[model samples]
Target: MSKSKSKRVSIPRSEAEMPSHVYSQLNTSFRSQDVEGDTNLPPVIRSKLQDLFAQIEKEFENLYNENLNLHDKIDALNEKLEKENYNPERQQTIFESTDDVIPVKTSKHKLSGSSQKLKTAHKLKAQTSKIVSSFKTPSVVCSVVKELRGHRDGVWDVAVARPGVPLVGTASADHTALIWIMESGKCALRYIGHSGSVNSIRFHPTRDLVLTASGDQTAHVWQAAITPDYNKTGASSDEDIEGGGEGESGCDTDIEGGGGTSTLRTPIAELTGHAGVVSHADWMSGGDLIITASWDRTAGLYDVEKKELVNTLTGHDQEITHVCGHHSQRLIVTSSQDTTFRLWDFREPIHSVSVFQGHTDTVTSAIFTKREEKVISGSDDRTVKVWDLRNMRSPQATIRSDSAINKLAVSNLGIIAIPHDNRQVRLFDLTGQRIARHRQGHQRMVCSVAWADEHSFSSNFFSCGFDRLILGWSIQNIKDL
Candidate 1:
């Protein structure tokens, strides 16, 4: 009786009334001053309390605005679905050819011995065999043949060496650029010269030189040597060479350990003119000049031989994200954080020839098709837009994705590989038809994807991401279509 004398019953509140407890606590804190002898709080304490109340009010306002935005997004998505007449329950795959049609499987045990029946049975068997063969001998859409693991930090970019070189270069957040033997996936050489993370790296179009852009506000051109220098102790496959320090073995300029090939950390040429971090650098078709994009809201064209800045393309209102030289045309495409992509003529770097402005957010990446007739760009708005250079006033097509895209790679076989923030690498045809999608291909955001070579459309490409993994994927044609 004594133990149960004064038990306080607790009642659970409904979902709508859950905030009553919080309101009670706030009321108690404010009413305490009224109950106390000193009804007025100290000026400092009162000011602090007012600031806290203001912060809470601002937070609630932000949450309300966010809810409104989300509701509008949902409505927009519903409108798009209605416009497209998309019916998930009755999804159909459109086939371009009759060869993709296959008959339903049925029991053959109940068939009669009539000649016509036997002929029909033979035809069915042949069709089944052909389909099974196709399944067994499927073309490589994507296969992870190798996993290059040397960078201790996230790899920001990767570049495959020219055909027959069997080498690949990687720019890493660990403040170094590395070369790997493509065949063995071994760290063949390491270039350590940047004071900050290497943002982008590229092999000279036709030379043995590699150009690397760094967050240190500089780009370096390094000499890549394929000769095996066994006399010098090479760095271990997993070791990272310090950018400017001597090795533990007292080697001031070279890495302590060398791989099959050697990459001197001492840069042959340092292109340092940008006031902000350089994000991207690419060589012109002939490798005679280089184009770079920087956070300083400018893109610069530099003479490779003269090692001097030629012209700075200065029209972007925000940071320039990426720069790419056209394969055949003299045009250069530059993507920017201002939600637009600009095409600048290298011959006339002072002005942009055409500006594409449809993306709602930052334009993170852009690339030119093989012949430079079209440009494909990916934006933080989760859309891939194709713009015909001939008509730059409007986009030719818009391909929507579930997540924001980081990079895009176009193959010669009309396949486009887009790595997105959702950790998916999707393949689409030039017409925007989704060919394939590798969901959760990496554990984290995929930063970049590149076709291994011109002949790589048969099923070879490389991808690197924030997961610290470099994966090789092969593309396979759909078999059960």
Candidate 2:
């Protein structure tokens, strides 16, 4: 038998050990040099050149195999981590709350009726084009001014107190609510009466009281004070906090750190009657009554003084997601997962119900803009519809987004502050023109957003997310040309 030739095995060169000059030589133009197959080369030199090309091809194959091995190891590590942290039950609950998002682009409706009264469609197009053309750069610039932290779980809602007190209240899933000093980032007081998560909170329109809705099927009115007595007492006992028990009508919170004597630890009253979880509650423009939306598919009208549910407005076919009181009217609107929202006149309750049906999925939030003239509704379908109260037949305009919306706040200038599930906060003009897109600072889905003081030159807003952090954002107005 003929002697077998010894097999040659090539080893991969480490990236650092690879010859640097070889890369430069390979990158050189082949047209300027004699190729390996050229007949002008001597036979010995030609044979050597072929060997050099073979070596380069072997090195390339080695590098490619090494890269693929690294990728396979990384993928295995990621899969292991995912398996270690998986929770199917919690995943199902979240899916039920916001509905699974297929991640699409869609939203609609007009700000009001007049924007739709365009004599010609071309005029509307021209106006939109002018707005777009004028914005050569981002008109609004916002960044996280502060990151407030304290709660053990995600913050669901945040509300700013009147200017003088300089207080910010936040509700959380940690079975507690915190009142933080806006300037110092210190937790002043804590509320812990609810047996379940505190879902929403709103500061009293004219007093130092906060109304908090919870998953425990109850809403509690408590003192929201910023005095020295309650300062840094976030560790106060739960019994000491809810000392007044259920319904004992206390006093207003003295936010100025003055000598006013009022009990700040106990809850004032607990509004009870919801069969399911009370998602949210809001104070009417007049501040005498409070309206609540519950998972029971109805909204409750409560008298603030009596601390009792007076009427239950019913029409939706699914759980009510959010409720909002008209800015200056006795009307209230409730959004639900039934894909429709109903406008209710508290004066007549059941008799004066108007159903606005258009959203194809759950209506996440609905709010009145322009002094109850226009209603803006955000849905899980990734669309926000603007309905003119004057013409309820169709939408005034429509705004589309990439993610499902949670709760949205609108500035006095008709700009919508929309918080999304994709960890983005977007601002849109009433005409559906995107004003700004803020995508930083939150590690999880952004839950709720609130406007600071609208009268200031630089409009400021706050956003909270499932990352258990509250971020304060400010947008400096683009100076006029």
Candidate 3:
């Protein structure tokens, strides 16, 4: 129509691969830019341009940050390498020249080694101190002096034959007694023929005879030495007259003077008066009189030389267990199962000076201290009570034992040896302080203990229950300087 306005009409390609109108449309859009302001564009194109610009900005920022971090890393690496190559002498020189501070690494080995050596030296010094302390304390050294074994059964008692002689007499439960030579430790003679076990034995004070108490209800006296048979023509009254009427032959005179028969034989004397078992017998300190206790609740004083029962002291109501004479006084103390011990004046029949009490059970054994002013009694109540002779109502000291004390002996040095059912032989000073404990040998219930000397002593302690072995222990003081 109006050759028509000949207006150029452009269409945007929508689906066509090749379209002449697409190029015409881009030229038209550029020429018509004034159609919208320069800032105004299609929504889709504006958004796409904004996203692309944001991505480019982000990439530039990332590159700039990476370059800065690389510079810092290189600088740190170079500083560390410089420090590694630095010389301590150069650093000291720099510090001295400029008064600058320099860091230094300590010599760890030298300092640590010295500290370790100091600790080791301190430990060694402590160990040496402990050893020295132990060495400074008192210690005991013991040795077996002699061993005597001859009884068919356990030996119940042993006594020294004389003050310094190496001879001893032992009574056994085998119904026999033996005389032992301590030096050789051999049985010199066997005194047999007792009807029951021999419970106690003692040597005559000045003679070669031994006295033994047996369960047979009799006490026998025997010559310790063996004897030979001898003719009794001159000694017998009947044969003496037959030889006295005529001149006595030379052979008879030789027999009488030479004593060719048996000088070793001594007359055997049997003391019989108690109605019960004799528990113990002992010679007086003077060695002239003998005292004995019996289960019949009676104690007797006998003139050993005259073979006569001098006095029968009777007051206890139970078995008398022990008896001992005073060392300096004429008093005698006897203990019994009746839970009491009595002090008797042997010089006078009616003198019962004191009666000791406070034991809860049977008094098993008692002994007068060497001073004779005090008495110590061991009881089945597991206690050892010390009583002053002046006042016997209360005990001066009471020592508790782990078990019943079967026997007690005081050494001349004022030490007490106590044997009990616990199998230990304990030694205590007169002050009742425990000084030492010795195993009479492992686990044996030690029943008897005796002291053989003053400061140094030996014990004849026997065990019955487990070990059933008789043992001897020798102990002596180790003084501290």
Cα RMSD, each candidate: 16.7, 25.0, 47.7
Displacement of the residue 219 alpha carbon in candidate 3, Å: 1.6
Ranking by lDDT: 2, 1, 3
Candidate 1 residues lying further than 4 Å off, grouped into runs, are 1-140, 228-263, 347-352, 455-459, 477-481
lDDT, candidates in the order shown: 0.67, 0.68, 0.57
User: Which structure is stronger by lDDT: 1 or 2?
Assistant: 2
lDDT of 3 by residue, 373-412 (tens): 7788988777887777777777877776545676577765
| TM-scores for candidates 1 onward, in order | 0.66, 0.66, 0.58
> Which tens-of-lDDT digit does each residue in 1-481 have in candidate 2?
1121212222332452221111111111232134643468787987787788778867865764464354335545644543344333543354344422322443334323323443334454454453333233458778777777767777888887755667778888776777766665555666777766788888877777788888788888887655654432322234454323222233213222212212344577889998988888898886788999888888898998998888888889998888998867888899888888998875653458888888888888899895448989998777888888889898887886546777888766777888876567888877677677785777656788887754342326788877788887767773321
**Residues 1-481, candidate 1, lDDT per residue (tens digit)?**
2331222222222222111111110111233343354647777787677678778857765654454344336545644544344332222222122233333553464333343554665575554342223223223355667777767666778777777555677887777787766655656567777877788888877778889998888888877645442223233231333321223332323322332334355676889899987888998888888999998999988998899998888889998888898866677899988888888875554554677788998888899988448889998777898888778777776777656688688876667788875556887766665666675357656788877764333326788876677887656553332
lDDT of 2 at 396: 80
Q: What lDDT does model 1 reach?
A: 0.67
In candidate 3, stretches whose alpha carbon ends up further than 4 angstroms from where it belongs are 1-146, 225-267, 347-350, 440-443, 454-470, 478-481
For model 2, the stretches where C-alpha displacement exceeds 4 angstroms are 1-136, 228-265, 347-351, 370-372, 455-459, 478-481
Clashing pairs in 3: none
Q: Specify the poorest-scoring 10-residue window by lDDT in model 2.
A: 19-28
